[model samples]
Target: MSTASIPKCPMCGKPRSAEHAPFCSTRCRDRDLVKWLDDGYAIPAEPVHPFADSERDDAV
Candidate 1:
């Protein structure tokens, strides 16, 4: 059995092969690296609420 049938890079959605499974090419891979360096992406620590936590608690 082989796992070579998958297509497209997971990061940039470009065509992928056995060689580059997650990125289509080195350029896309580097782009992701640059994004990290520039802080272009972020993961939220908690869900945002329009009202402050204290206000919500007071309302209840």
Candidate 2:
């Protein structure tokens, strides 16, 4: 018989709970959410501006 190891939580170096799966507890889960809400994670991308239909037509 073989048993696979459970992954540690990303926020804290603690074994994950089955209820939380990825996070060890609700506190860690909520902290992750707050980071996302505060823009703690950033993806590199080019800036974009929405154009009005008339403006698009003019450009075309």
Candidate 3:
């Protein structure tokens, strides 16, 4: 199997090492944790309408 190249740290934009996986260092990893705790990032989810299920009765 072929191995993919490691990705850079999202916070610092530095090359990542095997030991750190997606993060370049502990500092960068902690930075991500802090951001998560502070709600710095968000992932949007589909809004649910009150009558959406009834409108799409065929789907169920």
List candidate 2 stretches off by more than 4 Å.
1-4, 49-57
Taking the tens digit of each residue's C-alpha lDDT, what string does model 2 give over 1-60? Answer: 223476889999788888987999999999999999999999999876676667989987
Per lDDT, the best of the predicted structures is: 2
lDDT (Cα atoms) of all candidates against the true structure: 0.76, 0.87, 0.80
Q: Per-residue lDDT tens digits of candidate 3, residues 1-60?
A: 223454667778777867876888988888889999999898898888988888899676
- Collision count for each candidate, in order: 0, 0, 0
lDDT of 1 by residue, 1-60 (tens): 344655678677756755655788888788888999999899968877777888979988
Sort order, TM-score high to low = 2, 3, 1
lDDT for model 3 = 0.80
TM-score of 2: 0.66
* C-alpha positional error of residue 15 in candidate 3 after TM-score superposition, expressed in Å: 0.7
Candidate 3's clash total is 0
**Range of the 10 consecutive residues with the lowest summed lDDT in candidate 2:** 1-10
